[model samples]
Target: MHRCTLSKEKLAAQPGGEWTHSVSAGFLKTLGCLELLSVVGLILPAVLDIAPVMVPVTAVCWVLLLTGAMITRGRLGQVKLVAGDAAYFAIAVFVAYGRFVIEPFSS
Candidate 1:
């Protein structure tokens, strides 16, 4: 929400804000909204026991999002940042794998 709602100046004032310069505000806002929805999809359905299958699906979406982030960071020559994104991508992949294979939620 912060990234979607904050003014460009305010966003640029944040930590690691320099990366914001590499992308348009619209892109940032859209990414922020998608990320927010992904977080909800990851947690809410499982916790509420309504549609726990969404957990793995959302994790897959998160993996895709992080892949884009890694590519963007890599293009920007931010190798260190790409490593962080890769770490997150790995975690998302793990979650997806665990939910889809190891202990899947049955509908």
Candidate 2:
């Protein structure tokens, strides 16, 4: 979420920003909003003891998101970025599996 927010800021500050020029500004904002919602889905449902199943679902979504990022970075020939995305994907997978089958949150 923080990174998405920063990317939005970068896009706003410089419409033709080098790093962001590859993607549309509107798409960046949408991505940021989606990330914010994913965070909420990650925390609120479980914390409030309402629809706790959403926690693992959100984690799975994160895995998909990070996987897409890894693929994109790989295609861009950004090996370093792909490594970081892979790490994030692994963590998300761990959390998803843990919540879904290991120590699931009680509803």
Report the Cα RMSD per candidate. 1.9, 3.6
1-107 in candidate 2: lDDT tens per residue?
24466665555465223345577767777887888899899889988888999989999999888887777767767787788878888888998999989998875
Q: Tell me the spans in candidate 2 whose CA falls farther than 4 Å from its real position.
A: 1-19
Deviation of model 1 at 1, angstroms: 7.3
TM-score of each: 0.85, 0.78
Leading candidate by TM-score? 1
Task: Supply candidate 2's per-residue lDDT for 2.
Answer: 48
Number of clashing pairs per prediction, in order: 0, 0
- The lDDT values for all models are 0.86, 0.78
Q: Write the per-residue lDDT of candidate 1 for residues 1-107, one digit (tens) a residue.
A: 37778876677787556778867889888877888899899999999998899999999999988988788777778788888889989989999999999999988
The lowest-lDDT stretch of 10 consecutive residues in candidate 1 is 8-17
Best by lDDT: 1
lDDT of 1 at 30: 89
The count of backbone overlaps in candidate 1 is: 0
